[model samples]
Each structure stands twice: as structure tokens, then as C-alpha cells.
Target: MLYGLSYIFTKQATAVASPLALLGWRFLLAFVVMSGLIVVGVIHVSFKGKRLRPLLLVALFDPVLYFIGETFGISHTTASESGVFLACIPVAALLASAWLLHKYPTRLQVIGILITLIGVIVTVLAAGASASLSLIGYLFLLLAVVTYALYSVYVDKASAYTGIEITYIMLTAGAVVFVTMALIEALEHGNPQALFSLPVKHPSFAVAVAYQGIGSSVLALFLSNFAIAQIGVNKTASFIGISTVVSIIAGVLLLGEAFSSAQLIGAAVIICGVYTANNTFHRQKRQSQIEKKSD
Candidate 1:
């Protein structure tokens, strides 16, 4: 839900601040909140042997490349178009798992993936003539999907090896990257102060930034990492399809956006696909575990 709502906030915030500037403030605040949690013993931080490189890679894939692509992509493309593309993250994660972990998706899972993709296509097409497509915007959104998929896989491994401490490190690294990017964006705009000034210039921008910082960045990241660690990547990724549904609802409620009947049907189809995929995965996993125990 936070991830879905983040798109709405990002769109609103980007109206007042550059994507990089919004990201800088978002992650900076998230980092501070996370650090305070550590200080108060709400969460512990530890970096033991041989985990730094993978943790850094996860950070780079996520907040750095993923946000750069997603923010810029949404700024340039229609929300429907962006949502359609972002819906592909689960499929990308499935393929990444096949390649990286040698864990190929089952036939049922493959069918679910195809159905989910078709549903997203139907939903976006139902948005009608207003759904504009920008090639550059799609390119960036695709980058977001790929990089985030990679992050999903890597963060699962990192979490297993080192626990949720990696979340803090990832957020810290992301904060630094976005702060630098914000400065560069400000420089390009001929006002270096815009990095810090823009958030204060608009009240809505500040609220959007804060919601993204605490809800989306900090809480969502922790939940996602915890889910991946507990259930593995394919199951975790399957739930991403529901974000499309959440995005649609949020658009209607928060942004006052309208959806066509076809889009509504598509949303239902997406939910069904996610359910089918996750259930199939769970059954197969249980069978595998049972067989192993018997052996």
C-alpha cells in the first residue's frame, strides 16, 4: 500500500520539486528516522564479515537506480502507463531468480505471469486516449523494474546473511546518492539552493516528502525485506501485482482519477493472477519440504 501510494505522492511532489530533489529529501528524512530507531534500540545495526559489497549493490540497485528511473519515468509518462510497466517487476524478479539462483518458475507460475501481464495491458489500454506513451519514459521505467528486481533478489540473500541491518545501510547509501543527485540537478537549474529550498516552498511538497520518507521508504522497505527473507523472492514478488490494484484505488480516492469498466475488470484479473501464483508457489514449496523431511 505504501509503495502504491508513493506514486501518487511522487507525482504531486514532483510538481513542486525536481525528482532528484524530492528523492534527496525523502531518503534523507528516512535515513534520519532509521538512525533514530537504531539509537533508541528499536532496531539494531550490524555489519559483519563479507556482506558490505552485496549490501552496497542492493542499495545501488534500489534507491539509486530504481528511484531515478521511477521518478523520472512518472514525470514523463502517464500514470497508467507507468503503472503498467511497474507491474512487470514481479515477472522480472521471477526471471532474475531463474538466472541468478537457478530456481526456474513452474508452469503454473509462468501462466500466472502471462495472465498478470495481460491484465495490466488491458487496464492501461482501458485508460483510453489519455494514456500517452513516451519511449524515454518507458525506458526509464523498465530500468526501474529490472534494478528493483535485482534488489529484491539480493536483499533477500543479504537479509538471510546479515539480517535487517542491511535496510539501514541501504537507506544511508541511498540518501547519499540522492543528495548528490539533488545538488547536481540544482546546479543544472542554475540555483544550487533549490536542493533544500524547494520542499519548504510548498506545503504539499513537504507532506509528500514526509509520507514518502517515513511510510514508503522506511516502513515499506523493511516490510518488503522481511517478506522476502521469510518467504523467498518469487512469493514476495507475486504480491507486487496487487500494487497495481492499490494504485488504481489510490488514484480514485486520493487523486480523483477515473477508471473505466475494462480497467476494473483488469484489476480483478490481476488479483486473481497474484492469488494463483502465490498459492501454487506455496503448495510446491510445502511438497518439497515434506519430501526432504521424509528423505
Candidate 2:
């Protein structure tokens, strides 16, 4: 739900402030809030050995590239459309695992991947035919999904070495990157004050930033990590499909964005494909683990 609402907030916020500026403020606030928690003993932070490089890489894939792509993508495309694209994350991750980890997928997973690709093609063609979607926007959203999928893969490895405290480190690194980029953009535009000024221009902008920083970034991250720890990553990941529904509904209700019938059908197909691919892989994985245990 938080992740879905983040797309809405990003769409709303970008109307007032540029994508880079909003991301700068969002991560800055997230960094500050998380830092306070660490100081107050609400969350402890620690790092041992040479885990900094992997943590930094994870940050690079996530809030750095992911947010930059996502915010700009949402600005150009409808929130509902962007959400449908994001539903492709699992498919991207599945392919990435196969390529990087050499874990070949099952026949069902292969069919699911093909279905996901067909759905994407249909969605893009439908949107293009309607003249309501931007090609650049879809590309950026695809970048966001790919980068996030990389983050999901690498963070699992990095966090195992750095502990859950890696979340704070990743956020901090992301904060630094965003703030620097924001400043650079401000300077390039010859409006050095815009970085701080734009965010305060309206109450809605501030609220958007707060929700993104606190709710989506900090709270959502912690809750997801906790859920994964409790129920395992596969079970937790299965819930991601719900975010697509939430995002589409919120876009229509809150932002008054309309989707064509074809677009809606495309979104449904994408969701079905994602769910099928994700669960098939997880089920096969579980069975493999059980077989190994018996062996």
C-alpha cells in the first residue's frame, strides 16, 4: 500500500516541483528521520569489515537511479500506467537471477515470462495508439524496474553480510547522492536557491515529501524487511501484486486519471503474468529446498 501510494505522491509532487528536487528533499528527510532514530536508540546502526562497497552499490541502484527514473517516469506518464510497468519488476528480477545466478527457470516460469513480455507490448501499443502515453516515460519506468530488480538481488547479498543495518547505510548513501544531484541541477539551472525554495512553495509539496520520506521510504522499508524476516522473501514478495491494484485505484480516485479499456486489459494481463511468474519460481524453489533437506 505504501509503495502504491508513493507513485501517487510522486505524481502529485512532481506537478509542483521537479522530479530531481522532490527526490532530493525526500531522501534528505528520510536520512534525517532515520538518523534521529539511530541516535534515540530506536534503531541501532553498525557495520563491520569491508561491506561499504556493496552497500553503496545497492544505494546506487535504488534511491539514486530507481527514484530518478521513477519520479521522472511518473511525471511523464499516468500513475496507473507507471504502476503497471512497475509490476514488471518481478519478471525482471526473475530474468536477472537466471542470468546472474545461473539458476534456470522452470517451464512454467518461462511461459510466465513470455506472457509478461506480451502484456508489456500490448500495454505500450495500446497507450501509443491512444496517444496518451509517452515513449520516454515508459522507458524510464522500465529503467526504474530494472534498477530496482538489481537492488533486490544485490541487497539480499549485501544485507546478509552487513545485517539489517544495511538499510540505514543504503538510505544514507542514497541521500548523499540525491542531495548532490539536486545541487548540481540547481546550479545548472542558475537557480541555486531552487533546491530549498521549490519544496516550500506549497503545503501539498511538503506533505508529499513527508509522506514519501517517512511513510514510503523509512516505514515501508522497515516493514518490508520485517515481513521478509518473519515470512521469508518469497511469501513477502507475493504481496507486491496488491500494490498494482492500489496504485491504479488511487490514480483514478485521487488524481482523476482515466485509463482506456485496452490499457486496463493490458494492466490486468501484466498483473496476471507477474503473479504467475513470481509464484511459480517460489514454489519450485521451495520444493527444491525440501528435496535437498530430504536428501
Candidate 3:
């Protein structure tokens, strides 16, 4: 649900601030809050001897590119539509697994991916350009979804790092990248003071940033990494619907976003395809065999 609510938060932030500035504050706050916890010794994340390459790539893909694409996407599209587009992550992960992990997708998974693509097309056509859906927005959301899939693949590779360690690196990298961009944007606008003054004028930005930093970036990321470690990536991907469903409901109820019957039908079709592609029974068994052989 945290991931789902990220859209609502992103949408709210976008209304009050530009995308780069929003991401800047969100990830900066996340880095500061988590860093404070470390100072207090509430948690520990040691990376001295651990391999950092894979986790760095995970950070790049997720909290960096993922947030940039997602914030921009949400700015251009309805939160509900962003949620639907994000539901395609599992399908993207299927492909990523094939490429990164050398785990070829089964026929059913391929069918599922194709079905998801069809659903995406149907939803887009149903939405048209008239109904708050922008082609640019959908394309950015697609980029975000692909980054998330890549994140999962690399996180699987970086099994040596604990979840909190991974989360810390993500927050650190995101803060560095976005804060710099935010500064550059402020400079480009010749209003450096606005970086601090904008959020002060818009209190909603602070609220949204807080939720995103503390709830989504820190705690939720840790939980996701833990789940992936415990149950494996495919099983974790199977639950992608939980976030999608929550995002849809939150968009409709909280934001009063209106969606059409065709869009609803497309969402259902996407969910079914994601479900089919993400089925883990035989895949899990096979993955275990592969792991054993590798070990």
C-alpha cells in the first residue's frame, strides 16, 4: 500500500511543486531521517566488506530513475492511470528475469506479458488524449515500470546486502542525484531561494514529502527487500496487485478521480495477465533447483 500511496503523494506534490523539486525534497528528507536513525544507533547497516556494485545499480534503477520517471509521469497523468501503468511491473520483471537471471519465461508467462501489453493499449485507447491521459505520461510511467523490474533483478543479485543497507544506498543516491537537479533547476530559474521557500509556502508539499520519505522510502523498501529475500523475487512480484488495487482505490476515493468502464475493463485484463505471468508454483520449484545447482 505504501508504494501505491506513493502515487497519491507524488500527485499531491506535483500540484504544489515541479517534479524535480518534489523528488529532491522527498529523497533528501528520506536520507536525513534514515541518517539520523543511524546516528542514534537505532539501526545498523554495514557495507564495509559487502559487494556494492549490484546494490548501486539497484539504487540507480529504483529510487533514482524510478522516482524521476514516476514523479514526471504522475504530473502528466491521473494518479489512477499511473497506478494502472505501474501494474505492469510484474510483466516487465518476467522479461528482466529472463535477461538478467538467465531464467527463460515459460509459455504462460509470455502469454501473460502479451496480454498485459494488450491491456495497456486498450486502456490507452479507451482513455484517449481527451481523458487526462497523455502519451508522454504513459511513456514515462513505462520507464518507471521498467526501472522497477530492473531493480528487482539487481536486488536479487545483491543478496549480500541487508534490506536496510540497500535502502540506505537508495536514499543516499536519490538525494544526491535529485537534490543536485533541484539546485540546478533553481539556478536555471534564477530563483535559488525558491528551493527552500516553495515548500514553506505550500504545506502540502511538506506532508507529502514526509509520507514519501519516512513511510515509503525507508520502511516500505526495507520490507520489500526482506520479502524478496525470504520468498524470492517471483513470489514477491506476485503480490504486485496489492499495491495496484490500493492505488486505484486511493485515487478514486481520496482524489475523486473518475475512471471509465473501458478503463476498468482494461485494468481487470491487466490484473489477470499480471496474475498469469506472476504465477510462481513451477517457477519457484525451478528457481530452487537453479539455486542449488549454483550453490
Please report the candidate that would top lDDT against the real structure. Answer: 1
The lDDT for every candidate, in the order shown, is: 0.82, 0.71, 0.80
Question: Can you write out model 2's per-residue Cα lDDT over 155-252, one digit (the tens) per residue?
Answer: 65564543347667667877898888889988999998866876667778888999999998888876765554454333344456556556666877
Q: Predictions ranked by TM-score, top down? A: 1, 3, 2
What lDDT, from 0 to 1, does candidate 3 have?
0.80
Candidate 1 vs 3: which has more lDDT: 1
User: What's the CA error at residue 115 for candidate 3, in Å?
Assistant: 5.3
Report the number of backbone clashes for model 2: 0
* Tens digit of per-residue lDDT, candidate 1, span 1-295: 7888887987898787777888888989999999998899988876655657778888899878898898888878986788778878888999998898777777777777767877877887787635556899989999999999999878866754444577787789889999888888788889997667766778889999899999998888888888888777887787786767787899998889997899899988987787777778678789999999999
State the lDDT at 281 in candidate 3: 58
TM-score of each: 0.89, 0.75, 0.79
After the best TM-score superposition of candidate 3, give how far the Cα of residue 5 lies from its true spot, in angstroms.
Answer: 1.7
Q: Name every residue pair that clashes in candidate 2.
A: none
How many backbone collisions does model 3 have? 0
lDDT of 3 by residue, 83-183 (tens): 56876787778778878888766776677666766665566556553446599998899999999999988988999998888889999999999999999
- Candidate 3 clashes between residue pairs 3 or more apart in a chain or in different chains: none
